[model samples]
Structures are given as C-alpha cells and as structure tokens.
Target chain A: GAGVSQSPRYKVAKRGQDVALRCDPISGHVSLFWYQQALGQGPEFLTYFQNEAQLDKSGLPSDRFFAERPEGSVSTLKIQRTQQEDSAVYLCASSRDGYRGEQYFGPGTRLTVT
Target chain B: AQSVTQLDSQVPVFEEAPVELRCNYSSSVSVYLFWYVQYPNQGLQLLLKYLSGSTLVKGINGFEAEFNKSQTSFHLRKPSVHISDTAEYFCAVILDDKIIFGKGTRLHILP
Candidate 1:
C-alpha cells in the first residue's frame, strides 16, 4: 500500500506571499496530523484532524496559519503571509486509530521563504 | 504539559560498534514512549514503541529502547550499527491527543 504523500515537496515563496501545502493521507485513515520541522530541530505539532473535524489546533503558531480536511482524506495547510521564520519542512501523518495507532509519515513539503 | 529532552545533540560511533542515544521525559502519569528515525531527505520511520509491561522494547533495523520509569527516561540503543543507521533520531511521547517530541539526536556512523 502507498504511504502518506505530500505535494509540492519543495516550495519557495516571497516574504509576503501566501502558500498552500497539500497532503494525501492513506485510504481509510481516520486521523491526520500536520507538523513543522525547523532546521536541525525536532518536529513541532501544528494541527490535527479526525475525519474532517479538527480536534486539536493549539499547536498552530499564529493566525497566519489555517488548515482544512474537508473530505476527511485530503488536507491542506495554508499560510497567509510567508515569513523567513516560516521556512521549514511541513510534514503530514496519518493513522487508523486516531491517537493510539502508529502514525505513517509523508516525505513532507519543504517551504523556503525568501 | 509533557516534555521530552534528548541529552545529546549528536553522537558519533564507528560502524558495527555499540551506540546509545539518551532521552528523558517529564510527566506525572504513565506515558507511551516511541523512537523514530529520519533518514536524509526522508520522512520519519518508527523504530519502536513502549506502551506498557515490558521495560525493554525491540524495534526494526535491530534498534531497541528501554523504558526506565524510575529515571523517567527511554534511551535508544543498538548493539551493532550499520552505516545506514546514521540519521536523526527523535524520542516522542503521547500527550492527550497529540505528541511531544524532543530536539532529536543526530547519529553519525564513522567508518
């Protein structure tokens, strides 16, 4: 079976531009997660979705970030205004049993803000 | 809130030699511990996890981790590592519905 996948593996955006990263979770996966990995650091939680209903979003840094999983399978993380500090790899993960199941990760989308 | 701490930022060991990456967490209640490995230009892969019962947990690629409740630590170890073992390792713990990760330890396999 295919693992989780993210689109736009690499993206470069101007400081004020907006960007959207996509994620495709494995089929039938009910839980999805988004994380931000800064250079040389561990991944930080961003947001999570359980079948289209976002359960936890306290990890979101600020109002500039927004996410949606309308159909419960595909998700998108949108950054309103890019900043140099926003440069990092955005990872997406999915699991079958919500929080208890082991998560499967995607290659991630590396966003570089210039 | 729960937090994880990885004592070492980087560790270098010769190929086929033993290696250990230290991790400690702060939590008042029982927790689930996990070790994940990230290869260059790749996503994270789960090496192993410790839910309960056993203090010693074995994982893929011959990697293992021990859960020490008294020490509040879960350190990863490999008796003999291959060059492929060189990567970033993260120790994580489940907090409510989310996970908290440590800064990560870079394992450098020296030839």
Candidate 2:
C-alpha cells in the first residue's frame, strides 16, 4: 500500500469485552508506532516497534493493553477487558529509523466502549 | 519524560488575517519539535518541524514556526489565514526516542 493501513475504522465493544486493533505499516518501514487519542486531545504514544522488535512499551496505560508485531510489517494492539476509559481513536504510524523523517499516519480506528 | 503544552485551546481568525498558535515543551534532554494539522475526518499531516540549525523553520501551506530553546517555546505563525486553513493543530516533542504531543489547538478561520 502507498501508506500505513489500519483495520476496522470503527469498533464498538461492551465493557469487559476484549478487542483487537490491527495496523499494517508502510512496506519496508523500520519503525512503527501506536498512539491513543482521546476526544479533543492529541495522540499519546502507546508503543513502538523497530522491525520485529518491540523497542518500547512504556506508554501502555496498564497490563490490560498489549501489542505485538511478529513479522515487523503488521502489528496488533489487543485490549483485554475493555473499559469506558479505553474509548478513543487508535492511530498507527510508520517511519524510517536513524533519521528525522516524517511519520505516516493512518486514518485511525475509532473505538467505543459501551 | 517529555511533555508539550499548547496554551491556546482555540483560535479564531478572520480570513486573510494573520494568526499565531503557541506551543511549549518540557524535556530533560535536547528535543525535536513538530507541528501537525488534522482536518475533519482525516489523519494528521505534518505541517513543519524543527530539528536543528536556524531558529525558524518553514512548513507547508505558508506556515512557519520559530524554536526558542531559552523560552522552551515553538510557536507557529502564518502571515495570512484562509477558510481552508481551519483545523486542529498539535505540537509534539521528541525526547529520549519518545514522542509526546500537546492537547491541541483548534484553529477556526472565519470568513
């Protein structure tokens, strides 16, 4: 694809339910990132991946949140026991490592917890 | 830890008038600054960035920002505004390989 791709542009899940959000980064990109944007707020970093390695996960709000990129091209963010506070837009971006390049963001997945 | 603050939650400007949006950041290490714009129902687009060199950096859409390390500010400015320039603007700072974003400023260009 020409740009980063995110699946399920919108998702609705009940409280306590589990959900998974997927991101397909630009091909050959070495760095991928996930962010969470609340209403009227800017995106907050969630995690980062360098190729297949999960370089950083410090921003994950809690243990309920987990992310992985097995092959380095595609990543998944899984939330166990979704809560109302988890409702937000999940954005995925990819960029090259070692240089200050612009990150390409996807349309984002709007998640709602009932 | 890194943090960015956009002092103005909203800015309203008449078309053709000049506008400025203020942003500040706090970081323990040297930083990279960036501004991103988000239109309705669209993803964010990078407007400009300040990595190093001159204090002033120009970005797309005739927008520019000045980095003031002493004051810890990177304010975005435009000489003229248009209706189409209305969007949500975000300030970001990269610190210790982590990116931190501000709450955002909503720019409303009036006719």
Candidate 3:
C-alpha cells in the first residue's frame, strides 16, 4: 500500500465484549505506534513497536488494552472487556526510524463501546 | 512529562487572509515540535517540524512555524489561506521518546 492502512474503520462493541483492530504499516517501516483519540481530544499514545518488539507500552490505560506486531509489518490492537472509555478513534502510525522520524498515520478505526 | 496547549479550539478566517494558530508546550528536556493537519475522514499529515537551527521552518502548502524556545511556543502561520486549508491542526511535542499532542484547533477558512 502507498500509506498505512487500518482495518474496521468503525467498530461498535458492547460492554465486556472484546474487539480487535488491525494496522498495516508502510513497507519496511521500522517503527509502528498506536494511539487512542477520545472525542474532542487529541490522540494519546498507547504503545510503540520497533519491528516485532513492542518497545513501549507505558501508555496503555489498563491491563485490558493489548497490542502486538508479530511480524513487524502488520499489528493488532485488542481490547478485552471493553469499557465505555475505550470508545475512541484508534490511530496507527509508522515511521522510517525510531529517532525523530516523521510519522505517517492511518485513517483510524472509530470504536464505539456501549 | 510533556504537554501541549492549543489555546483556541476553533479559528475562523476569511480566504486570502493571514492565519496563526498558537501552541505552547512544557517539557523538562529538549523537545521536538511538530504540526499536523487532518482533513475530514483522513489521517493526519505533517505540516512542518521544528528540530533545530533556525526558529522559523517552512512547510508544504505555504505554511510555516516558528519555534520560540524562550516562550516554549511553536506557532504556525500562513500568509494567506485558502478555503481548502480548512482542517483540524494539531501541535505535538516529543519528550522522553514519546509524542504527545494537544487538543487541536479546527481552522475554518471561509470563502
């Protein structure tokens, strides 16, 4: 693809349900990032992956929020026991390198937790 | 910890008029500043970035931003904006290897 791609542009999940969002970064991008954007708020960092290694997960709000990049090219963000607060636009971005590189973002998946 | 503040939630500007979007950041260590623009139903695109050297940085679409270290601000500006320029602009800061964004400012360019 020419740019980063995110799957399930919209997701509606009932409380306690589990949902998974996928992200396909640009070819050979070394850094992948996930962010959660609440309504009327800026996107907040959730986690980052350097290749297949998740180097940062400090921004995950709770234990239920999990992300993985098994092959380093495609990634998934899974939320277990979804809460209302988890309802937001989940954005995925990729960069050429880890240090000070420009990040290219995906269209994002709008998750609605009821 | 680092935080970015975009004072105005929205700004309305007439076409061909100059526009400025203010942004301020707080960080304990050296930081990198960036401006991103998001069109409707689209992902964010980098407008410009302030890394080092000159305080004033020019970007695509005739947009430019100045990094003022003394005031902890990196304000974006365009001499004349077009109707197509209407979009949500976000200011972000890099601190502790993490990028944090502000609430964002919706720029409405009127024809």
Candidate 4:
C-alpha cells in the first residue's frame, strides 16, 4: 500500500512569493494533518482536517497560511507572501482512526524562502 | 494544555551498546504514547505505541519502551543498538484530538 506522499520534495521561493505544497493521503484515510518542522526542532501542528471538513486551523501561525481538503483526500497548504521564517519542512500525515490512530507521515516538502 | 518533553537533545553510544532515550508528558488523563524515528532523508516512521494494557511495548528494529504511569514517563530503550539506528527519535502524546511531539533526540552511533 502506498503511504502518505507529498509533491515537489524541494522548493525555493523568494520572499513575498506564494507557494503551495500538496499532500496525497492514503486511500480511505479519514483524517489529515499538516505540520511544520524547523531546523533542529520537532514538527509543530499547522492544521487538521477530517474528510472534507476543516476542523482545526488554530495551529496555523498566521493569516498568510491556508489549507484545504475539498475532495476529502488530497490536501494543500498554501502560503501567501512567503517569509524567511517560513523556511522549513512541511510534513503531512493521515490516520484511519482520527486522532487516536497512529499517524502515517509523508516524506515532506522542504521549502526555502530567500 | 498538553505537552511532551524529550530530556536529552542528543545521545551518543557505541555500536552494540545499550541506549535509552528519556521522554515525559504533562497529562494526567489516559493517553496514547508513541515513538517515531526519522532517517536523514525519509519520512517519520512509527516505532511503537502504548495505548492501553501492558506497560512494556516492543517495536520494530529491536526497540522497546515502557509506559510508567506513576512517573508520567515513557522511555525508549534498546539493549544493543546498531549503526543503522542512528536517527532522530520523537516522543509524542495524544490528547484532545491532537498529537503533541517532543523536540526529539538525535542518536549518534560510534564505532
């Protein structure tokens, strides 16, 4: 079975540019999560979605960050006006049993803002 | 608010030596504990989890951890580690429909 996967393994963008990171969760997964991991730091929650409904966006750092999962499978994290502070690895995970189930993570997309 | 703490930032051990990575959580209610391993250029992989029942839980690559309710800790231990085990380990706890992860510990393997 294919695990969670993210596209564009690496990305480089200039400050003020917009960037979008995509994630494809495993088939049949009902829950999806996005996290940001800075250098030498653990991943911090960004947002969460259950099916096509966005349940939690409290973890998102600011208004520039946005996420959506319309079809209930593929989710995208879009950043408007990238900043140097947004340079980090963005990880996506999926679960079968919502929050209680073990999360399966993707390889992550490393974004660099210059 | 729930949080996880990884006491050590890094631990260096010789190959074939025993190792332990300490982890503690700040939640009194029943919790789900997990250990995840991340290689240099790979995604995080689940090592093991303690949801309920037996305190000692075994995981892949000959790793195991014990869940201690009294001390509020879930420390990962391995009798002997291999060079392949060199990676970043993260301890996480689930509460309120969210999973919080510790800073993570880097395991350095020496010859």
Candidate 5:
C-alpha cells in the first residue's frame, strides 16, 4: 500500500525567503501531522489536522510557521522569512484517526537555510 | 502534556547480538506508546506499538517492546539483530491527540 509522501526532498533557501513544503497523506487517512527534526535530535511536533480542520498547532515554534490542509488529503507547511533555526527536516505523517492509531510517516523534506 | 525520554543516545552491538533500547515517558493522562525506525534519508517506519492488551508487543523486523505502565517505560528489544537494523530509533507517546517524541537512539550494528 502507498504510504504518506512529501515533496521537495531537499531545499536550500536564502535568509528571509519564504518556503512551502508539501505533503500527501495516505488514502482515507483521517489524521495528518507535521513535525520538525533537527540534526541528531528527535522529531518535534509542528501541527495536526483531522480531516480539513486544523486541530492543533501548538508545536509550531513561531508565527513564521503556517500550515494548511484545505481538502483534507494534502497539506502544506509554509514558513515565512526563513531563518537558520528553521533548517531541519520536515516530516509528514498520516493515521487512521486519533491518538491510538499508528502513524505512517513520509520521507520528509530537508530544508537548509543558507 | 506528554514527554518521552530515550535514555541512550546511541547503542552499538555486534551483528546477531541482542539489543535493548530504553524509553520512558511522562504524562498526566493515559498514553499510547510507539517505536519508530528511521533509515538514512528515509521516513520513519513503525517498529511496534503498545496501545493496550498484552504488555509484550511484537512488531516488524523481529522487534519487540515491553510496555510497563507502572514504570512509564516502553523499551524496545530484539533477540538477534542484523546489520540492516542500524538506524535511528525513536520513542513516542500520544496524549490528547498529540504525539511527543524523545531525542532518539542511534543503533550501530558492528559486523
């Protein structure tokens, strides 16, 4: 079965530039999530979506981060004014429903702010 | 809020040797535990999960985990490991519909 997928596997951007990362969740998955992973560190939560609603965004570090899932199947995480601190791997995951279900993750997009 | 801790930053073991990766979590509410493996340049793959039922849970690639609610620990174990098992493993807990992960443990398999 096809798993979650993300695009722009690697990206390099100048400081202050804006970048958008895309994620495609598995079919019929009711839950979508985004995370950030720094080098040698565990992934930190960014946001979560249930269907088309943005349920949780507390883990998004700053106001510069914004995420949206208009149709409930695909999502985008956009960062305005890219900074050195934003350089990390952005991971996407999908699950059947809520907390108890297992999440399937995407390969992630590595963003390097240069 | 839930927080996870992976006690070891790295673990090295010879091929075919047994291994254990320690994980502990803290939460005021009931939690669901999980273990994920990430190969180089790859996304995380679910190794196993402990939601309920038996405390001993078996997962993919010959991996198993023991859930200890009293200890707030979900440690991953393998009786025998292959070279391919070398990767980053993460311990995570889900509470209030949010998933929190630990710093992760890097497994190095020596031939």
Candidate 6:
C-alpha cells in the first residue's frame, strides 16, 4: 500500500530470546523513526534515520536495542536478550522530508516477552 | 528540550456531545505542535499539526486544534463526537527533529 507497513503484527518471545521487527516506510520517504509504546503510555522515540544515516538514538533504553535502515527504505529493530521489560508495541513512522511536521505511521508490532 | 503535557488522562462524553482534549508544551527553540490518534491495537495517525500560519488548524475526522503560542498550548476539539471516535489521543511537539509526546488522553464515548 502507499502507507508504511510492518511485519509480524504480533510477536511473543521468551526471556533471553532475540527478536526482530521490520518496517517498510513509504516509498522514497526521506526520514524514518522508531518508537516504543508501553501499555497506557504514549510512544517514546527510539531512533531516527535520515536516508541511510542514523542521526539520533538517545531514546533507546539500552544497548540491547538496535535499529538500522541500510538501504534507507526497509528498516529493522533488533532486541537482543530480551527481558520482560522489553514488551511493548513498536511503532514506525516516516515523513516525506526531513523535519516535516506530518508523518505517516504503520500499524505497529506488538511484542510480548515471557 | 521539548515536552508535552496532557492534563486529562481520560475524558468521557455522550455521543453527539462536544469534547475537548487539553494539551500543553514547552520548548526553548522553534517548535511544531501535533495531535495524534490511536485506535485499539493500532499505531498513531496524525490528527492535526501547527506549523506556521493561522493559529487554528483542522484535521481529518472532524477534529480541530488551536495553537496558543503565548500559553504554549495546543488543544484538540470536536464539535460533536461519536462512538467511533473513542480512542487514545496524543499531543506531541517537534523540536529540532526530536518529537516529544505526552502520555495521552483516552477519549471514552459514552453510549
């Protein structure tokens, strides 16, 4: 579709298991972002990419979380050695250009760690 | 640094009644204000944004917001609400590429 799309709408992982979430941003969008939303909370920024460069990732809770957009289109968020605290909905959004006020978002991937 | 505050965690209104969701923000530099809506089991969609121009902005689904720079506030409103409008609303600000979001306000439409 024209909007952003995410894979594996839902995921369940055991403690110590690694998980990967994929996001396909809108065609040719210049800016992409990842955010984590816990239950009853708003989304918190995780990382952002302008083209193929990761400019900021300060919101990433720990080193266990990593994100990449090697081709500047499809991106992946990886969580290594996941713990219960890692459970949340992972959201992906994209803007037509850098610093654009409007952004398109995907349905998001719900991750549950047991 | 930028931050958004949604004072009301939950707001209830009967169908067809008007409702308002309050939001406040703070930023040292130039910023953009936004309102996002999230349905159950879904991600967030932009409802409206205040970039530049008129203080009032209109968005999809009969939603509107007024940007008050002096008060640092952007509150979302709908003249009439529906049960379908029940969802979590988030207020956010874009400051130098960082989007700070509020905890959100859940709009409960009473039948």
* Backbone clashes under 3 angstroms, per model: 0, 0, 0, 0, 0, 0
Residue runs of model 5 more than 4 Å from their true location after superposition: none
Misplaced by over 4 Å in model 3 are: none
DockQ for model 1 equals 0.74
Error of 6 at B57 (Å): 1.0
The superposed Cα distance between candidate 3 and the true structure at residue A86, in angstroms, equals 0.7
DockQ of predicted candidate 5: 0.84
Candidate 6 ranges beyond 4 A from true positions: none
The CAPRI class of candidate 4 is high
Q: What is the lDDT of residue B25 in candidate 4?
A: 93
Candidate 3's TM-score reads 0.98
Query: lDDT of all the models against the reference?
Result: 0.93, 0.92, 0.94, 0.95, 0.92, 0.91
lDDT measured at residue A18 in model 2 versus the true structure, 0 to 100: 99
C-alpha TM-score for every candidate: 0.97, 0.96, 0.98, 0.97, 0.96, 0.95
True-vs-predicted CA distance for residue B86, candidate 6, Å: 1.4
Fnat by candidate, in order: 0.61, 0.66, 0.82, 0.84, 0.92, 0.76
Considering the two chains of model 5, state its CAPRI-style docking category.
high
lDDT of candidate 6 over A41-61, digit per residue (tens): 888999999999999999999
The Cα RMSD of model 2 versus the native structure comes to: 1.3
Off by over 4 Å in 1: none
Candidate 6 colliding pairs: none
Q: How close is chain A of candidate 1 to the true chain A, as a TM-score? A: 0.98
Model 3 per-residue lDDT at A75: 98
Tell me how far the alpha carbon of residue A50 in candidate 6 is from the true structure, in angstroms, after superposition. 1.1
Clashing pairs in 3: none
What is the RMSD, in Å, between candidate 3 and the native fold over all Cα? 0.9
Q: Write the number of the candidate with greater lDDT, choosing between 1 and 4.
A: 4
